[model samples]
Target: MDVKRIVLLISLALVSYLMVLQWNQDYHSPAPSVATSAPAPSVTTASSNAVEDERLHLGEAPTPAAQAASPQALIQVTTDVLDLRINPRGGDITYAALLQHKQRANTPDQPFVLLQQDNQRTYIVQSALEGLANRGRIQFQASQSQYQLQEGQDSLQLDLAATIDGIPVVKRFVFQRDSYEVKVSYLLDNTSAQALETRFIGLIKRDNSVDPSQGEALGMSAFLGAAFSSEENHYEKLEFDELRERRYLSEVQGGWVAMIQHYFVSAWIPDAQQTNLYSTRTDNQGRNIIGFKGAAQRIEAGQQAEISANLYLGPKIQSRLEAAAPYLELTVDFGWLWFIAQPLFWLLDLLHDFLGNWGWAIIVLTLLIKLAFFQLSATAYRSMANMRKVGPKLQQLKEQYGDDRQKMSQAMMELYRKEKINPMGGCLPILVQMPVFIALYWMLMESVELRHAPFMLWIDDLSMKDPYFVLPILMGASMFVQQLLNPTPPDPMQAKIMKMLPIIFTFFFLWFPSGLVLYWVVNNVLSIAQQWVITRQIEQQGTS
Candidate 1:
């Protein structure tokens, strides 16, 4: 083996492997296929015992057996961007689907369901008063079973009314025409002789199911679990397993808690001006829960007070997320290279705005990156060409110093110096660019903008693997040609391994997203072109 080449290969492999392992840990198993027909929402809530232990300051009593057993009515609400079901029992959001995003690229009519409570998965949002004893079991009544935004309407509000301990309370869910943030508020009519004191608690409870929005691809997976922002920390994440091991608790002013999966996220943004308590715990049914409770509010007799919070349920679109809450956009994770990835994504998004196509945007972004690093790449290619020019001389030196490692090393170093070539010149420049490449990989993997995007013929969804396997093949062919332009290793074993790299990489990329594979194919082709021209010039100079 060539010591330098072997070491470089091992180093690259180690870095890539570590990155993949980290990404795998961030994700769970592949999500079960979306059901053809939606199932009824499950009637579930956090256990009373678990809530008492957490000391959420929810001074509530046990749920009445009769109320808990009764079949709760589900109120359906439809807006321009949202279609969701509200359970009148706790007035929880039992199911939600994004009307704009489809469950599958081919199924244009079926909207992508974000929160559902059925046999396969259990993810729902709950909001209730902290002081009321029957908060979780209140059978609120709605004026209608279904509500839809009018043709010219810009917003819609659905109210579920119930009396808790003789205090008339109304839970209202407010939805806007083109917004994903739903305002959930409690209207307290304190008509009794005494004052009504209560705090608003909003939470999201979900089971350990894989991210249904994630595509089945041989690529880095997105992070799935609970994330929140606090006064001490801008953003923090805990995996389901980690949440199970220990409880997470924090107190901050104006923070939000969220359940994140792949491209979509559901978060509860509490009152920003007042301090709130945030926590995470598992429910009786093993569902992970993250929630926050606002500061206590006292409603004097014959007074009306409204306590409200925002529930954002939709894609991780940066603009929407930033508007939803501070640090909420961090949920669109791009790994440790976010600094580079964010800029790259910004440029890609800008290009997409002009081109109106993600595939073309990616190609243009790759070209831009190549242009930015043109000088560095040229230097690297020039070094490789010089190495090719001295290949014959290096082979003669190896043969002359056979079985004498020290002399062979000295002879190769002398030849390289005499030729004014740096043996590591090509590799160092490429190594300097690895962080950018890895950052781009993460950016492409995590961006929902490219989810169902299409390129030219044979590629329908940029987020899905290429059905024809054409891009990977082209990528492999380009890699082979690029290798041909470089100096071949003198050792037979090393040379054979190098020859197999393209084949191995092709198989590895077979299941990658077409958008990602397209980028690779383009990059490889460009590199080959640059290396070939430089190699031909060096060869001509040698002959002359």
Candidate 2:
């Protein structure tokens, strides 16, 4: 076997392993449903248990206040890109729908709902003052049940106020017209004579809800779990099973905890300047809670203090997330090839900005990559053309040295040395470019911008596989043509395997996203053109 065949086999093996791993991860029997009841708000009065200095345990259920307040109403907040419902009880975000992203490509009117607190699925953002009271559970009062950004208004604020133990605490949520980040703050007025100590804790509670996008494609599954970053580890993913076994704990000056799905994510970004303790745990109701607690702050008598945090609820747009917090863009994961994939995605985005169409942008990106590797490809093609010229000589040697394996090998080496040809030359260039192709594959797979993007006729969603499979068929044909241009191996078995590759790849590409297949089709067509030209040039020189 040649180096090229060895490399191809290894690549195929790695891909098969990954596919099995993904299958096992996605197809496991579903875990039993956790109860979806919201926990009662805990009140920490002067005589209550002294709060832990920095640690926030999951198993500790705070004592509910004896005095039960009236049920607060739910407030609705709307902006250009987001429509959210906030429950005044605990001031938790009950529902968030992204207006810009639709649930289906054909159904543009239906917006994608990211966070919903319902019987079927329980996902919410909750915050509270750890030592004094559970602000998330307390019944705060909102002035209005509905708030919207009026014409010419750039920002809107929804305020919820409550007096806990004579301390007036105000929770404010600020929303901007064109942004998905909400600024959440707690304004505390300490009127008592004694100093009050408390810590601000923000958390995201979610059940292992099924991802709606999982059934869209066969043998594909997007990540659905909790992820966080800290000073020790830049990014860490905590699966639901792992959370059940052990708690995730870390202390960082500034970091974030997020619940990430396929296309969307919601996160709690704490104050950047304060050292916070982050942990993840499951409540008695079986809801997974990933939260962070800020360092304790002492408020003197008659003094006021404010604890602020940012909440991001929207699609996984890399640029916007990076602008929101440090290392936030890492959420758009590209696996181990991020270094190459990131640059390729940037170039694709740049091309889209110029071309104004994702399909054309992919073609242009493929053209540019081919141009960049033209010289190396030309050398590879020249080597193959020379091998094609010596095909008859190799066959004759094999016939003469039949049944003498050592003599056949010696004759092949002597022929190659006399012709000054390198058997591995063609394989080296292909090996060098394989990583670039794989990186582009991942970039196309993860980009949410292409979710419902249209690309000419019959290709409406670039993120989904082609409905008609036309691109994949053309891609297979192009691969066959390109293979025909390359010199056939002297070994019949190897040549037969090479011939079957195009058909095998075509079947594989049929299930890939249309955008990925389009890229491969364009790349193969360009390679055929380049190889044909080089082969013709070498043949004419030999004739002369």
Candidate 3:
């Protein structure tokens, strides 16, 4: 009936929603296996040939020692946006760093490493041929180890050559300037007397290491495992622990499999024209592998066949991901309410483009959201205003019905009925807006554009918490002011707890992303302005 009850209901609703999310993360069942019109080969069958099985098992040969044997063995390729290392042993991308994204806010020189193969952790992209034969250890030889994109160069190409069963195979990686997508093509010049039946396999293998890209403590857990796009589902998350239970197998056309962390992702997108077999399994060393095997291509004697797929290894930029493959932008993972979140982000980005500052954009977005919900908020404020106007009557009833619980409730209900007030009107409107608020929270937390994005003075990175807790303090102050505008609860205990809501929320928000906190602060300020005006208007009319 009063501000305290509304606040309590909102708190309970938020907590219940978060608990549901956590529950889904822990115990959510996996989707049923998706099958295409044509049957794709199984993992074992894909590598069924004895010769292919020996060489195709990924993460096996190119031991850390072998990969670390010499710098010459690792080919370094640098583009405008990417710095990557290719191991010549199996033509796998051993290391990939985003040249444009910093690892930490304070360290501008250190780039964020997305994939690495060192003693500390093993997360790398690998490619293997599934039907090749006659191989001791396929060692690729590069023309030159270090390749850099020149100032005028728009693209760079690095080719690693190896011979398998007298066939010359060239693993070519093409990198474009200012782009994170790499075209990995395996060119097989089959000069043997027999036809070669081989499938191109692309795998992303990584250990269960904590995501280094995760920001501040006590934040919502970002998905830290594998995901894929299928014809049936646009995006499906496959947690690392889920892979341990049973391998994920799906056959689909025009799909991609990726390893996603907080702000970064690496996906292998096969050709969209053919059916691909996608699977996930833990290797011998307890590393999770999610990859796809393209349809088998038959290369006749003395014929040349080129099998290629696109590798996206960089920050999860929605535009870039969408350009790389269909439904790849869903990797942004804005939760279940993406339909709402998507438009919210679009508007936010548009505001950013106009304002040229993320902080200002957030404030303006909050104002716009408030305006859109003006009618709903007005209904709530009017209800609270009416309740405040009858404060003395409620107090009188409490005093007259002291220590008599039934009489007190009856008096309150009768008074509400006479006043034509709905006790639930204030809470229901807010409960309706809870989903949008949560969606915005996820959008802000998961947006790579906001990472290290500066606002104005004192707020250097919107993705991180406020360094000095200034915004959170201001947020608490705004909430306190809002409480002042609304009628206090008649119950003593309820009033006490309601008074503490601001402080409690302030502490919880101390660790949240500054961008999200900014939104809340602005929303609260706007609500205070609106409620103050309505309460004054209602009071003046009542007095008159």
Q: What is each predicted model's overall lDDT from 0 to 1? A: 0.82, 0.80, 0.82
Candidate 1, superposed: residue stretches over 4 Å from native: 1-3, 14-72, 133-136
Error of 1 at 437 (Å): 0.3
In Å, residue 406's CA in model 3 sits off its true spot by: 1.2
lDDT of 1 by residue, 1-544 (tens): 2546866686559555844643454454544332222222221223333344343533343332321222346788999999988877778787899998989889999999999887678898887787673344567899999999989999998988888778888888889989999999999999899887878888788888887887677387578899989766888988887776677766668989999999999999998998777777665455677888788899999999999999999999998999999899999999999999999999999999999999999999999999888889999999989998999898898889998988888888888889999878887788888899889988998998888888999898998888989998998898898888888887777788779878977876777889999999988888887778888888899999
Off by over 4 Å in 2: 1-4, 12-73, 134-136, 213-215, 218-221
- Measured against the true structure, the TM-scores of the candidates, in listed sequence, are 0.91, 0.89, 0.91
- Where is model 1 poorest over a 10-residue stretch in terms of lDDT? 35-44
User: For each predicted model, how many residue pairs clash, with residues at least 3 apart or on different chains?
Assistant: 0, 2, 0
Pairing residues by index, what is the TM-score of model 2? 0.89
Sorted on TM-score, best first, the list reads 1, 3, 2
For model 3, state the Cα shift of residue 222 in Å: 0.5
RMSD (CA, angstroms), candidate 2: 5.0
